[model samples]
Target: MTAPLILHYAPDNASLCVRLALEEMRLPYRAVLVDRAKGAQRLPAYLALNPNGLIPVLETPQGPLFETGAILLWLADTQGALMPAPHDPARAHALQWLIWLSNTLHPAQRMLFYPDQYTSGDTGALRATTRQRLITQFDLLENARYANWLDAVTPTAQACYLAPLLRWPALYGGPTDWFDLARWPRLSHFARRFEARPAARRAALAEGLGRTPFSAPTPCNPSEGSAI
Candidate 1:
């Protein structure tokens, strides 16, 4: 029998995206906690798997895969689900949004979460600016032509990836008063629908996310490991 994939993760981190996808696909995998409160990610042992010391590192037959987007894409392709097939015309649209989530929206959130990483001074101003940028990004996403995927009855990798991004702003980084899911009705609707899925419910339980994790997120009370 093929070895089950191993996912090194911390609760409520980007790894949650992968866990959601795994559950959606009903794949066999083991979850290993990385305790961020203990600085476990930066330790040499974890570094060997992901030199960047990121929260997630999936041990696959090919090798250890880091980066949440890459792992989600790999799972979609390998399992032949979650994303449009290679020859499908919709594949272009799917790839475009997936890359946007990884390169644009995710980094914008990171900047809001850790402004000090970008600037040594005036982190407050940095966060303030990032918050507005995130709003604009969300607005664009709300009206994107291909946004039908967000509410599809069958979950997609993009939906798995997006659900967590929608959740974090309300719970993490700086003041969340500026971030409201209801501001974008379409995205808000997507959140409510996505979180009700069996896959989402299972991932939420595993990570200690509340029942309405995506639509009405609360700070995680993970059974193990720290979210920070």
Candidate 2:
């Protein structure tokens, strides 16, 4: 007997990537919303699944899993699709970026938007510093000459991960000029292409992110979190 798949998600959370991946793979699963605004993630039941109190805890037949990157890799490997072969060099490359995105880029985003979550003092200066760091990180990615497997006919886990994080920096009420979309033409183009995909659209709609997903390079109207 096959174990069931259940995804605990908050609308517009990093779970967006997992939802998009499932749709891309045509996998069936249930999504349970963990309302952060109402503190559902902190409840004892949810805490049993993920002590981190973060959005997006994926419950698999084996057990509950936290961390978006790990969940994505597991799905891709187990589903035998949406990622390079396990031993392929491309798979290694993909893992490298996934770690960087999850560890560095994701936290930078959290710091920029929710500095208060990390520090008690005034956060204005810290946000500015973090924004610059993010710009530098983006610069590295822009010039890395990395191949976008996501730009393929089928979207990969890496592509799914990139789409949301790229969108948030532009729309998180941070200074627009600090991280302008125009600066990273390659990434901007990548995001636009991802947004145009049917699977991406479905995920966006399912997450209540509205139709015409990623309409413009402006602040996202929906409440979103990157604590994957």
Candidate 3:
């Protein structure tokens, strides 16, 4: 039988999601890093596993899984917790939050923030359009803070990824930090509460990062050329 081995880039968004769940279960696994700066992820060996050349690929006895949402969901299903207790309202609720994170939250923020990182063309204009999507998603979540989406019993997987992004200054530095959490005190409160978990702390440290994930560059909107 193959041990669960995860191939990921430390600072990538999807890697964070798996790290959180892996810690929560205290599962024994190995982390093989793909340092993007050196272009390791695009190497043929890595591409053989995931032709898309994306990070956060999990190689298991069952094969490989990609994408943050699927990776976390696969973990939860194996454990049978944090995903509602079958036929419960929370089952549908948990799925909804996961879908929102997959379809809206992650993509919108990536587009707004990582445009130049991916393309040489004007990312600023695309970021402007994506920013609106992020704000709307944030507002929608705020509108229903009490909806129990963040409950420990079924803590939506969204937090496993989003909280770290919010806290990492390298990712959201400067004036934007004010807007990132100011209007979302409830969400921030929830994030703080979640981050305090032992599992969460372990996940943060497991990447062997000497500093917080926020230490990276914050790109300008794509309208301008790449930040660096």
Candidate 4:
């Protein structure tokens, strides 16, 4: 039997994305907590796994894999599930949106969550601007021709990636009053449907994300390690 993959993760962090994907895929894995509250990620031992000290490093038979997007894509490709095969016509479109989640939406979220990192001054202004940008981005996603790719019935890496992105604004984005999932009807529907899945439920329980983790998130009450 193949050895279980090792996931180095912190509760309710980007690691949650990988955890959701793993559960959806029914892949065997072991979860090892990295206590972010203690700055364990910055220590040399964890740095050996991910030099950038990011959350969610998957220790594969090939080696340790970092970056949530790359890890998801690798899992999809290796397992031959959760994404379109390379020769399929839909593969290009799938790759496009996946990269958008990684390069575009995720960075905007980072700015909202940690405005001080993006600018030395006027973090409030930066957050306000990023909030608007996120709204515009969500609007574009709502109307995208490929919006069907985020199907609630069939889990995709994109869906796994997007669910957390959708959840974070409500919990971590400062001054979240301007944000409302209801504004984007399709995404709102997606959130409700996706969070109802068995895989999502298991992930929520493991990570201490309460019911309605995607549709209406609350701060995690993880049994171990802080989100920060």
Candidate 5:
């Protein structure tokens, strides 16, 4: 028998990517809602699972794992899927893109979504700068060899990571008018195709994402306070 997998997540958070991966893997797992709105993640119990107080912590029999990139890499490596073979040359390229997406692109999105975390006041410039930097990052995908990010029939970890990051600008960036997908046709098409997959479709629906999830705004509630 296999050990059960548990994913501690919050809606519309980076956890969404992990969920997509799990769905793609066709693996059975349980989801634990670390309701950010309820300050659940910051609470003592949840912090015990992930000291960083971040969402998307995967609870395995060995222990709880944190960090989105590490978790994705672990899943690919252990499951022997969603990644190229270790001896394959393409494996190196896949690793490179995954790291860049996690370290570079992911942080940029964070800055745009939660500028207050990085800046004490007047986050306008920070948000603007980060947004532009993000656009350039996507441009690399638009012009790179792996413009599709996948030669395989199904979505990979790279695609899973990219999907949410691509949706970041429209959801959190100041206004829809500021950023345009028309600027990067290749990247736009890639997103459309990835989202069309059955696994992607199921994951999106499970996460309460709409057809135009990129344009879906983050839910706001004055009564519920959450830093995450």
Candidate 6:
């Protein structure tokens, strides 16, 4: 069978999650670089493929799946292992957190890190305020969601989807004083595991991401965060 083609121009973190799922499952697939950093995803060909112009377009035999969460759910259902079986209570519970990461955690990062992309400059102050509101939601998610990050009983979709958020405040180059990793020890511990996985390392290298700094312990300069 021909491997499905996955066209992704994800800005490092988004690509990371899909790469993790694909590698963990050992599925044969193709990775087409949309290279959003170079404005490739914004081109007409890519826009036609995904109107939102987001990375992570997973082209399966069934059809194309856009959005990372959508693609993840498709993978889990078709392959049914990244997550537990749907009929199982743990599966439904895990599924909720997966959706939460996509809907809640992911959106917060976009607002906090790339407000300019989704909103105008005139709305900068307002966008920043809105991002704070979103951050509260993310903080709530950190506290109440992904409670099983350290359980490791059967790999219920835990922190795999949250690597981006763990790196978010740093990704945008900000004070970690307000966003505490110490508060979520389990996830902080779990995140380190896959972020250093051989497959993850290979994928990051393939995407041209800087090797030494991939798992950033330091924040970027506050003023230097740019839209990708």
The residue pairs in collision within model 4 are none
Tell me the TM-score of each prediction against the true structure.
0.98, 0.90, 0.79, 0.97, 0.90, 0.78
Q: State the lDDT at 227 in candidate 6.
A: 29
**If the candidates were sorted by their lDDT against the true structure, best first, what order would they fall in?**
1, 4, 2, 5, 3, 6
Q: List, in order, the clash count of every candidate structure.
A: 0, 0, 6, 0, 0, 0
Candidate that scores best on lDDT: 1
The positional error of residue 50 in candidate 3, measured at the CA in angstroms, is 1.6
Question: Weakest 10 consecutive residues, lDDT, candidate 1?
Answer: 145-154
Residue range with the least summed lDDT across 10 consecutive positions in model 6:
218-227
Which ten residues in a row are the worst by lDDT in model 4?
146-155
In TM-score terms, candidate 2 sits at 0.90
The reply for model 3, stretches above 4 Å from the true place, is 116-121, 151-156, 168-178, 208-228
In model 4, which regions exceed 4 Å deviation? none
User: Which scores better on TM-score, 2 or 3?
Assistant: 2
lDDT string, candidate 1, 1-228, tens digits: 167899999999999999999999999999999989999999999999999998789999998999999999999999999999999999998999899999999999999998999999999999999999999999999988976797688899999899999999999887899988999999999999999999999999999999999999998989998899
Alpha-carbon shift of residue 126 in model 4 (angstroms)? 0.8
Cα displacement (Å) at residue 118, model 1: 0.7
Best-fitting candidate, scored by TM-score: 1
- Where model 1 places Cα greater than 4 Å from the true spot, the runs are none
Each model's C-alpha lDDT? 0.93, 0.78, 0.63, 0.91, 0.77, 0.62
Pairs of colliding residues, candidate 1: none
C-alpha lDDT (0 to 100) for residue 94 of candidate 2: 80
lDDT of 6 at 53: 78
